[model samples]
Target chain A: MSNTQGNLNTTAEVGIVEDGGSFPPFDSTTYPSQLLWLVLSFGVFYWVMSKVVLPRIGGILEDRRDRIAGDMAEASRLKQETDEAIASYESALAEARKKATTMAHDARSKVKAETESARAAAEEQLAAKLSESEQSISKITAESLSHVGEIAAETTGELVKALIGGRAPAKAEVAKAVDAALK
Target chain B: MAGNSGNAIDPIHQFHISKIFPVEIGGVDFSFTNASLFMVVTVAVATLFLVLSTNRRGLVPSRAQLMAEMSYEFVAATLRGSAGNDGMRFFPLVFSLFMFVFVANMLGMFPYFFTVTSQIIVTFALAILVIGTVTIYGFFKHGAGFLKLFVPSGVPAGVIPLVSAIEVISFLSRPVSLSVRLFANMLAGHITLKVFAGFVVMLTGFGAVGVASAVLPLILTVAITALEFLVAFLQAYVFTVLTCMYLADALHPSH
Candidate 1:
């Protein structure tokens, strides 16, 4: 490979050269055989690359693409389901809340209605008891006033009998006089 | 070899074409040369790299598998971007071309190894195949309208013929430029390195002065060698992208 072999390389120039003719690169003798080899080698590599290597890489890429698409689709579906679930859950909670509010309102109204009716009934019972007691008290007061009048007239007769000795007024006459006085 | 005879260090001599095994049929030489051996080696290495790296074909890639997938995606993306999804049909061709050229150029970087891409005939053959495929695809797909590729739509009536002629000439010169670009780059870089290496060898004489003088060429040789490796990969990329553009033209004849 050393270029000191003067007899071997005569066209080697010191600086950059242009197109070559006398150099081996310009040789036309080996064109056909080299071409034949090129064709064979190129054919083999082409078959391997197109049929084997490229297809494998393409398959990998396609697989990754499919996998990503599948994942995205799955994620979106799960999101939709989750959203639906949330919506249903919220609706159920709202329904429960509405039902509980109605029940509480009904219980409050029931308790209020019961309290009002009970107070009205207790007040009626108290008014009836008061009227009965007031009638009994008036009757007792009338009977006691008659007793006092009788006692006053009887005591007056006894006083007259003691004072006038044997000259006491008749019982009937005395009652008539007492009655007039009471009127 | 670098003595007074001055016959040992000839940079161009390394590219000499010689038959490793001599064969002749119909007065035509079909003999295998060092170039053929390296071509096989190129094929072997390229094929082996892909086949072994992909033998497992696991989801989590090893380094080799990553390398394999990277090259595959690199060419695939280039073709797809340049020619659209339909260009995927030509993925195998583009991938093979990239790998072959890249491996051949890299192999040439080693000592005592032949660079197949440095040859005009080899690069010319590949270029012709690409151009031929593009032309055939254009005609097959678009029929007679494929010729419209040579005529721009907005040219004035007076300048149409002149513009058409220039465009047609440019279009036809694609293969020449394509092949020459890679061949010339490889040829110039390798020849420069050989020349500089020869200078280093030649300067070993004259005692201290020779030693001091050899240092410059040695540094330059190192720098140029590094630059050449970069050029090797760059040329391969340029060739592949250009091929994709041509393929694009084939698919979309208007562009």
Candidate 2:
């Protein structure tokens, strides 16, 4: 390879006699080609980057950003909905608690009122029975006293008949005697 | 042939251009050469890497896609940082320049491969392209107001001419510095690596002691090669960064 390179350099030296063994970079003969190719190649590169490569990457990045934003929005919306649901559920629980308390209070008061009325009715019936019994006892006592008086009068008349033979007392006199004894 | 020759440790020999297919057009030698071949290879490799990586366009990006995206965002961020969002208009140009230079530099790191960016004309051409874009776009966008780039806003009236002159000179030197920085770095790094490698080769010509002593230069060569790799990436970055700054000047010329 070195020998070939040597040969090539000899040939290049012979072909380009004007180069005069100057530094390759400073050699102006190669500038036109280098510049030409640079322009052409760089031009093509610029075109590809601008027209094809950049847009594709840009589009991908934009799409990813949009998707992330959309996902975040959805998550936030769902969270809001969940918060609303929780709020409504709490309110409903509070309402139910209030209603149950009211119902229990009403039932307690109604039971108390029914018990009071029943107790009052029973007391009134007992009082009426006591008064009726008192009235019957008083009547029976009066009747028994009248019978005792009659018996007393009969006994007095028998004794008189026995003592004074054949002397009968008058009915009016007997009634008067009996009435005085009773008095 | 130069490698076989005992004392022929000519580092410049690697840079020599040879015609692969000689052709004449209008009496000018437009022959395809090794430099041209490498340029085409750089373009092909860069294109393939970019295109194939994004072929799937997966929302969940693959590794190659991630790499492609990183490169895009990296360049994009640099431009946006210096030139603002408006500089994105020149994204294609900037991206192309970066990829071409970076890939060309990386490919040249291979043994026996031709380095396209080592040529001054090529780097000069790219620098001119950047400066040309800046000048043309500056004038087109800002008209004569673009000249305000030379006139800083808060300068005293006394030194306005001096400041403007300095600004003009600096602006003019942008291309020269841009091109030379990259070209010199590559040239010097390669030459240094070649010279150190030549030391290792030359030392091995001695007996057992020479082979043992070659270890030092060999180690240095390895270290220099690593440094060259870093420089390869760095030069590309520096070139693109300057390009972005210049474009920024074009975008907003008033200091």
Candidate 3:
């Protein structure tokens, strides 16, 4: 291992110092080319990044942000419209319910008034007919009593004539006698 | 051991610089090397991932788009948290640094790939850029008052100079620490992984007992590789966070 180490050291020294007369990294001969290339490549890279790539990416990000904001605004606006529609519909429903209740109340009151008036008219007509019927009944009763007195006077006259051979009482006196008995 | 003196067991060989296309501009060698290729590849991959994933711009993001957006938001939040809203002016630079370092580290995790952040020069250059921006912008924004960052308030008059001197020294050490932190982490992690792997190879060459014992280093190598992945991400985050804090000082230099 030591022998290998020694060999490795010698090989490294010869390769680094003798072949290039200096370490490759510290070699002055390669500086110009390295610098030249570094400047050129790095310059190009910077130019491309600043001028082209960065702006496009930034623009994409910005555009996405704006679109999201705009979409959110549109969504909220639609929600607001929907909310307003619901509120209006609810109010309209409440108004219609109120109107229906008022109409029902008015119809009930009108029906009740009409029914009361009809009942009163019917009772008044019944009362008038009943009074007329009572008057007729009393008149009929008086007429019937007069007839009965006449009948009775006839019967009596007949009987007396039979008994006494042809004597008949006057009708007026008979009717007066029946009236006093009826009273 | 005697036969194995090649670059295979040499851990440092992986960091070697070999030119693919040798270019000389006014007698200076600015050749495109493996390091350069990886840097370009890193940028390409990061750019492609970001661009292609976000091409659709789906409001509900796809997996790829989510990953990309998360990365962006993560860095953005970090920057905003550390430096406040005013510190967002440095977002591009901070994001670029983070992506570059992160992708570079991840790409280097593959076998036979160059780790760009492991290069001191590269990390140093990045650190210098950060510190440079902080210094320049601080001065430009606050004029001479930017120097007040070193002279914190509430110190007694006698202790003010001592406090300021210490503060100045600490402020200057920011770049050194920042650069070395990333570079050293990458360098040490890779070296350790390579050495363990080399140990596996060396042990395996010693017959049946060697092969049986090589499992320890092999397992350790695997674990270290996993740990390296974490370090890659952590280093990137650390670098960007520090960058934000430094930029905060630039924007408000009082304390």
Score residue A97 of candidate 3 by CA lDDT.
100
Interface RMSD of 1: 5.0
DockQ of each: 0.28, 0.33, 0.30
TM-score of 2: 0.82
Scoring the B chain of model 2 against the true B chain gives a TM-score of 0.97
- Which is superior by lDDT, 1 or 3? 3
Worst 10 residues of 2 chain B by lDDT: B1-10
Ranking by lDDT: 2, 3, 1
Model 2 spans with C-alpha error above 4 angstroms: A1-21, A119-183, B1-3, B6-8
Question: Would you estimate the TM-scores of all the predictions?
Answer: 0.74, 0.82, 0.77
Give the per-residue lDDT digits (tens) of candidate 2, residues B1-255. Answer: 542452246677566677767867898877777788788889889988999999999999999999999999999999999999999999999999999999999998997777899999999999999999999999999999999999999999999999999999999999899999999998888889889999988899998999999999999999999999999999999999999999999999998
Using DockQ as the yardstick, the better of models 2 and 3 is 2
Task: Give me the overall lDDT of model 2.
Answer: 0.88
Candidate 3: residue A23 lDDT (0-100): 72
